[model samples]
Structure formats: C-alpha cells, structure tokens
Target: MSVGDETLRNVNLVTMTDPLLGQVVEQYRVESLIGSGAMGMVYRGVHQVIGKAVAIKVLKLDYADDPEMVQRLVREARTVNAIRHPAIVDIFGFGTLPRSEQPYIVMDLLEGDPLDSYLKDHAPMKPRDVIPMLDELLSALSAAHAVGVIHRDLKPGNVFVESKPDGQKGIKVIDFGLAKQADRAGGSVKPTNPGTLLGTPAFMAPEQVLGTKVTPSTDLYAVGGIAYQMLTNHLPHEAPSAIEVLSQKMQHDPIRPRQWQPSLDEDLDGWVMNLLSREPEKRMKDADEARRALRRIGDGKTTGAQPVSGARPAVRTATGVVPRRDWGEARTLITEESSGVHDKPADVSTDRHVSPWAATNTEHPAQVEVEEATMPPQPAPRQKFQSARIEAPTVAANPDEVLAEVKKKESQRSLAPVALPVDAPGEVPVTVPPSRAGLYLALGAAVLALLAGLAWLLSQK
Candidate 1:
C-alpha cells in the first residue's frame, strides 16, 4: 500500500477498534483519544504501575517518512524537559507504539482549561488577576531563558491554568514545538521551512513578523501581547488575516492598553509598554528586570506615576533622579521629566537605533501631535535672547542704526503702562534702556553744559 493509504488505514483502525485503548507503551496503558493535530494524536492514558493519569502524544504514521517532523516532536519533548519549572508542563515518558510504529510522548494530563478557552467563557480578567499569572509566566520564561531556550510560541492557547489539589491555581506553559536554541538560526525544523514566519500574528513581535532572529526578549513581547489581551479582552494587534495583522503592527503600534481599557491605570500601563517595546534592546533587559517591575506594581511602589508618553519609567537612582531607561543598557539622565502617556516618537532620538519597519513609513499623525504636545515652552528671556542674537549681525554692520533699533524696541516695550514703574501722580515716568548709547549721549550733553557754566563763573571772578 502507498504511504497515504497506509496512514488512512491506521487512522481507520485506531478509530474503529480503539486498538491502543488497552495497549501498553512502557508502563502507561492508552485509554482514549484526547485530541489530534496535523503532526500528532494525543491520548488519555494511565500508568499501569503507578496508576496515575498521563497524556500520550503520538506522532502520526502519515509523516513517518518526514524525518524533520519526527525530529521536531522529539525536540519539543527534550527542550521542555530541559527547563524544569512548575509553570511549564511536565514530560513523563517517550516511546513508540509497537502495533503502528507511531512515536509517542507522555506528559502531565492537564485537567484545566487553556487560558484562551477560560477567557472566552469568563469575563475579562482584571489586571490584578492577570498579574500573578504573568509573574508565574515570567518565572517559567526566566528559567527557560537562563538555559538559552526561547519559547517562540507563547499565546493564551499555549498556557494552561488548573486548580491544584491544594485548591490554589497553577499554571503550565505548553508546546515548545517552535522553540529554537538561542545560538542557532535558520536551520531548525520549522512548521514552515527554515527562515519562514513562525508564531501567531496577533502576538508576534515586529522582528518575528519580519522573520528576524528571536531572543529571550522576543518571548516577552508575546507576554506583553498576552497581558494586553488578559486586561482588555482583546489582542494588542488583531485582524482577520495574519498578513493584515503583520502589516498593521509594521504600520502602527498597538494602542496603549490604558487607552483601550481606562482602568489599567498609569504605572501598570507603563509596565506593559516596557514589555511591548518594538526594539528588543528597549524592552526589559532580561526576564528578571521584568519580574522586579511587576513586583513593584504588586507592592504598590510604582503608583500614581504615569510613565512619560512613549517612554519607559525612569529608574530612580540613589539621589532620587529618574534617568531615562529607553536607550537600552545605557543610562541617559533626564531629570524631573513629567510622566504621562504620549504618542511614541516616529523615530526615537537617533537614527541608528530606529525600527527598520518605521524607517520606511512617514511619521504617524499621532506621533506628530505627541512631539508638539511634549515640546517645552521656550522661556521669555530665552526668546528675547534669541531675538537679539538674530539681529546681532545687523547691529555689527551699523552701530548707529543698531542703537536706534534697540531704542525703538525699548520705546515699544515701555509704551505698555504695565511695564512702566509708578511715579509721583502727575509726573510721567520716562523709560530708559539700561546701558543704552542714548543714555550715554544725554549724560555727555549735561556734562558739557556744566563745564560751560563753570568757565563763565571763572571769567566773572
């Protein structure tokens, strides 16, 4: 029989007789089909020796000839096993079913709902409720990152939440199937071919959409996207198709979470923004930094302060100065700057680090408004100084003409009664330019008159 026919035959046999139902692989006895996907079938099973329930995920016979797919299944099991975190799902065993020659992996049978399902059934979760999950998520990611494993696929569907035997909630991050080692790129077995796009579009970082190398920060970008959904009942970027979603993210930033849901408050909004930074380096340098920022929110230390529009919260130093943390790993000091949600700059300060996606497009209209809104008002004295500087060259060309211009300006300024000093009721207050050539000219005339009077008095003597 052809490979296609053989695969169909196995599917029919498994469905009809449930042949694996009483069969044993290692110590686990397959009971029933739990689920099936393009790559594999999952079964609910019981460990014969321990009598504990475990999930069996079996690679389909249809793809037996596809070595890369087989390797990816094995890699998923091995990669997840390497990172030991409670928030991550556990792998119990791995083997092949003798009857069909299908490979299988045993994992913790998650009894709880996927976060995606839970959110659909329940009301939108409060930020407070989401914070703990994010904390655990970060912990899982932190462990994974420390060992150089980047969870390329992180979405609500991949996260499972269950109530433990102790009645407390527990989290399990599942499916490291798309995960790639930090050091290697463009060579791993991919759902699409190597270097092809991966990850759900709504949660994808700009780099992922652009098919660039992903790092630990790439995973956190998805965390931010998930947090946005948890808090707002929506994805940060959403469209009917993946291509449209990618186009939108490339065109505009996701609307600020606070703007979508006003209750997120200032600090929490800023914290999420930090995670969603388009530039990887601009994001929290590592998972640990992200955790501490969240901890600050939980502890209520970062209250009342909104981060500056499109800027990360300034890190307060020992001297109480809040230095800008946007430049990534390098500290630039901006003191006493006010914090408020503002439109992100089309190009953040220097051109060297501007997002490539943004470089091609004109600045968004909203960002223009932000640039205008955040612009500092020029001080009056500074304005006057600038005026004088502009006219300085003209003054240098003709001293008398420049002096006359200065006198005229002073005269115009003095005409405003409010600017004149109060004098005796009947007397008009004369305004003179301080250190003006006109004042010196009047003083010289007075001195000449006095000298003429002195000479006349001496002649009479």
Candidate 2:
C-alpha cells in the first residue's frame, strides 16, 4: 500500500478490545497487570493450553497505530523467539489480536525487586557477596551474545534475582525490549530527535552514550558499572544531568573500585577498571571469560582468598570518620529500618580480612553508620569531569541515521507503511518441541553418509 493510504487507514483506526484483560490468544488468560512502560503494559497471564504462567507484553495502542512501531514490535518478537537459553528470558510465542496492528510477546514471569532498589536497601555488600551476582549476570550475557542478541542496556534495574525451589539462587535478565539482532547493521530503536540519548545514561557504556555503533563488548562495560557499584555502595561517580554522566563515561577515568571500598582486592579493582575501560576493544571481549573469573571468586578458588598459615588478621581504621574503603558500609547495616526512617546499625563489625585483591589501610575498615538524622536536606552537586570531542559520524552508522529519520516522522501521529516483502508474505512460524531435534537430525545424517559410502564401495568391488 502507498504511504498516504496507510497513513489514512491508521489515522482513522477504531479502538478495539482491551488486551490487558483476558485476550485469549493461544489459550493464555491475560490476568492482572505486572508492569507498564512507554510502549505498553505487561500482564501476569497463564496459558490454559499448557497450564503455564507467563508475562504478556502488549504493544500500546498509541504505538500500535503507527506502522513503524508495529514493525518494530514485531521485529523484537521475532528476534527474541529466535534465541533459546535458560539464562536469557524465555519467549513462548507472539500473537496479534483480530483487529490490532501490533503483536504481543508471551514470556516467563520472573519474581524479584529491581536490582537497584535491592542494592539501595542493602549496600556495601561484602566483595565475596557480589561474586555470585556477577557470575549470574555474566552467564546471562554470555548466553545472549552467543545467540547474537546484544542487550544494549544492562543496568541494576534490569537484573532479577529469582528464588529457586531448591533454595539455590537463580537469575533472569529482562528488557530485551531493546535487544538488537547481532547481524543487523543498524538499530531497531531510533530517537525522533538528534543528540538525544536512547539508553539509560547512568549505566550506558561510553560507546553507547556516544550513539555510535556498538558490539558485545559494549554490554560488558555496563556490566562493569554494576560490579563497580557492588564493590562500593556509592557509584564510582554520579552526575546531576544524564548528558554529563554520558560525558564522563565517554571520557574520564573512573576512580578504581577499591579506592571507594578499601577492603576490595587489588586484582578485583584491576578487573573492574578493565571492564569499565572507555574503549570497548580494551575491555574483556567475552563475558564468559569474565564469568569464569567470577566463578573463581564465588567458589573460593581465587588465589587471593587462600588462608594464610602463620600471619594473623590485621586491624585497620580502629577510630576515624569512616575510611574511603568503607564509604557505604554505614548505609547497608540498617536491616530493620523503613526506606526513609532509620539510623545506621551500631552493631556492625568488619572481618578484618585482606587478600590479593583486597584493599589494605593502616587501620581496620570502619564500622560506623552516618545516621539518617545527620544527612543534609539536599544532596550535594556531583563533580563534573571535562568531556571529550565528539568523533566524526562513522559510515557504520548511516543506516541508523535512516532509522532516526523514520522515528522523526513517527511523532506526527501518522502511521506510514514501509515497503513490505511481496513474494513470501506474512509471518512464517517455527517451533522447537521439547524433544531433541538437533540430535535426531545429526543421527539421520550420519546414517545416510554410512549407507552411501557402503554402496559406493560395493559397486567398485
């Protein structure tokens, strides 16, 4: 259809059935609301067909009315369905209601508070405490990267810690809402305005902040930010504005992780710095290797954690305004206090432990909570670092520029249709059953090769 005709059809679209309720697509009952975003609301739903619980994300009417948004949502659903892994969010299927232009994704529902709220409530977690979390995050990233899905945005808010039936910990990384297919040269997301950021600024990698083309390594940079914050309750740094934070991420060197939490090990400090490297090429290229590093730490296999045979545990910071190493220790100790009401825990004590990666001070790590009553009415302004020069737009990003143009036209309330594939039209469905199709295919191919070889040998004889 012509762009003008498509625009008229969408402009006069009649509102249809509300999908947040029980829109029985493929036998799933869309029940209660779980969450909502700029795009649409997510519902806690159950599949009557399979008797399984799922989270259904329906595209918003405002966006669904636009052809570009409809295509974007469909692309996301297709990309997500293509990848299958336990660590990544599992997508069951996609469905479009009778009259809706866009589709919704059915996914596994995960339980947990956002990693940010969880951290703010429990900061200054021991270095050992953070290893397992990092291990899970890295494992998820590795699996996603293997399947050619780059989670452009990785932040504390996106990681969900789920409770396992057996009491062992499990994690699920969500919001592949922004994930891009690896082979695609351009982004599926576009900003209607130029120079406006498209990702979470605080956790976005330097390359992502610059709006430049990105690779798997870019996600690792954000992973580095999570590790850095975990090591110290405080961020390596913060800013009053998103653009300013992006500037620092793209240019300034972050203070070493151990500098904020002196108890952190030197090797860990180095690892965090390396992951947070401004240049993507310099960072850990593969998340699996980083996950292996996390495994060593969490499993008590890192050489630094070996117990000393003769040396006694040292005591640092016996009396002082808490050392830089113990910066957020006070805030994490108040277990019983409500979000806004509480004093620092006075019963706190440090392990006085030191390791190869551990930081050392002349005195023991401090154990004092700067009380809630003592805080100032307003927080102080964050120090800003000088931003670097913007590089020339690379040829690699020309397609992204086109996407941006499309997004600009999206805001006008007109839904223009782009050219569609004419020959093989509509969606082709593919599903993998629980049975091992790969194994069976391999066995069948092996039998065919063996028979063909025997036939050739017998004829020659």
Candidate 3:
C-alpha cells in the first residue's frame, strides 16, 4: 500500500480487551500504561515465569474485534520477528491478553528516546558518527524490504536507538503496525481510507505524497528527508495539507545541501542531496546506498565532490527550491537572529536538526466547517497527526466504519463509569436469585410449629 502521511487529529483511540492474560497471566504482571495507539495501550509488564521485565501491547475491544487490522498487525509483527538485526526491535511473542479476548504482542522492553527527539537534541554530528547509525538503519530497512515488507512510513520518531551489548549504540526500527507488503498497492484491501493520505508529509516521498505506487524507493525518499534534516536541520518544502505537501514532493526539487553548507565535504553533501532527488532512480536506491555514500564521505576519499568554504549566498535553484522558510520555524529563527545572540549554525557532531521552513496551507472552507455543525464536536488531528513519520497504519479503513467507531468510542467515553476489573471468569456470570414468597411461607410454618410445641409443653406442666 502506498503510504500517505496522516496527521491524527482529535480522535479517541480505544483498545481491545485482555482475554489471554485473563485476570491473571503466567508471570507477566501488567504495569501502568506506557503509551497508546489507535489499536491499544502499551504497558510495562513483568514476566513472572522468567523473572524478567517485558512489555505487553494489549488490544482494546475497539480494535480487538477488528480482525483484519489485528491480523495485519500480527502478520507484520511475525514478519518483524523473523528478522533479527541489531537495528530492528525484537518481537518476543504475540498472544491473547489475560481476561479479555483481545490479542497482544510481547516485545523486548527498550530504553531510549524516539529518533525525532533524539535528532532534535543532537545538534550536528560529524559524518563519522552519523554514518554508523544510518548504516544500521539502512541495513535494517534492506532486511525488511528484502522480505517483501515496505515500511510505508519511516521517520525519526519510528526509529529507536539503544546502547547495544557491543558497547555501541544500536538503532532498532519499530512500529510496523502500518507496514505493507510490496504486492498490496492499489488493491481492494488498501491500508488507508479513500483519499486519506498516509505517511508523514514532511519526510514522505513525492510519489508517496501523491498516493502513487511505492516501493523500497519510497522509504529511500524519507531517508533522504532525514539526511536533509541531518545536514541542514530543515525539511525540503512545507505545505498546508497532506495532499498539497505531496504535490510539492511531486513537483518541487529540494535545496541541495551544498547550498546550505558550502564548506560541507562534497561526498557527504552529495550523499545528502542524492537522497532528495525527485527521481527514485536518481536518488540513492535504499538505506545501504545512502549509508555507503555517507561512509565514503566520512573516510575523506572524496567519491563525489571536495569540500568548499564560506557562505556562497543561498542561491535560488531553478529546481523549485523555495527561499521562504516555514512560518513556524521562521518565527523561531527570526527571533534567534534578532536577539543579538547570532548563534553559529550547528556543527556536524550530533546530527544537529534544523526543521525546514514550511509554508502553512489554509484549510478548505468545507473542511474548516464540517465539524462545526456536527451534533457534538470533538478534537480532530491538527498538523501533527498529518505527519506520518512512523510506520502507522496509513491504510484507510472504511470511512463509515472509522467514523462510526470514532463516534461510538466517544459516546462510550461519556457514558462509562469508573472501571474495575471483573478479575475472574466467574465474577460476571455468578449471581444469587431473589427470595420468593413461598420461602417466606415455609419459614412462617416452621415458626408456628415451634410455638405450638411450646404451648403443648406448657399445658402438660
């Protein structure tokens, strides 16, 4: 399925019941919530049997009954489980949660921040450090795609980096909930809803934005965007809606990294720029190619161009590179420059991120007012939900079903009282019948007989 970036708005995501775990499961003690998704809640759980800490992802009733989605999740999880790479998260097992009948996937508990936050915190790492991480990611992607899996949505947030057993940081890719096989594009069982976009727009490929057929190259484009962020701390273009952003991907050419850092080593800059090529063929085909390009640059052999120096004045490329900065970012940059701090641009050491200046799009009139007249309005996803940076299920479900489910969940949220677990199977089914009038009559007769016997005894006395 071609992934479009879906920025989720104000929708309540409900999970399925935990039947496998029942009131009690083997050794895994369900801890407090960690995070949530449209399908279910992720809990920090302890495995009692093994005496190890584990994480259990429980399916809520809302999504549990969705057999198709569940199966898809299962299939993807199974697929992911088969690939044991240092850079891919490990899927331990999948099974039913305790009492409720919903399914859950048990995975290795990890400690690390999302790549998005990681990138944001790390400002400009030299190519040496960045290339290794990129290499791991590319290898993971290559492994995934080789088995007919396409990580329809790939972004910094979906990636996880942890200190490996080998004393180096290992990157693990996560959230294959929205992943699709190479064969499923444009078929009846589409991943997303009709006309709804999937994937994160800011980093999505031009074809992905257009909802066109995608391959490994689609992911390559997103990696390219990551490289863009890595080198210059910004995205290529900014648009209002997913559709428009996609349009930019199709029609616009991104600003070459060379223009931003004239002093950048040529191979590194070219590697970054190659990922941004509008033509999939022209761009680095996959993560490994991109990684290798980075590696070559870090070695200083100059596989492409030599490094330049000084500001060459940001030239407006005829290739659709917009000089305008994203308003959200422009405001911040303008403030930073105007405040007299005039900080130097981040040097490459930590993958210093500078978000591209995106031009905001105005909402269409109908879209703006659709929920206004609705019976009762709830929150819709703003820009964030639209940014499909991770492998979220971009495949749209039936629009009517999705909307109905969303509304049903909303109503349930309003009507439900505080919940307490039933705990055991017998709790819900066990009940005592009410007393009957015949029982009262029986009690009265017994008392009368006792009184009569006492009277007989008194007479005899």
TM-score of each: 0.63, 0.59, 0.61
For residues 133-174, could you state the per-residue lDDT of candidate 3 as single tens digits?
A: 777788888787766677777876677767657777667788
Which is better, 1 or 2, measured by TM-score? 1
Better of 2 and 3 by TM-score: 3
For model 2, residues 422-453, the per-residue Cα lDDT tens digits are 45657654432334667899999999999999
Candidate 1 versus truth, CA RMSD in Å, comes to 20.4
The residue-level lDDT of candidate 3 at 98 comes to: 43
Candidate achieving higher TM-score, 1 or 3: 1
Residue-level lDDT tens digits of model 1 in 340-420: 122111112322222221221212332322232233222111000111112111010222332344455445544432324
lDDT of candidate 2 vs native? 0.56
- Count clashes in each candidate, considering only residues at least 3 apart in sequence or on different chains: 1, 10, 62
RMSD of 2: 27.3
What would the TM-score be for candidate 2 when compared with the true structure?
0.59
Worst 10 residues of 1 by lDDT: 1-10
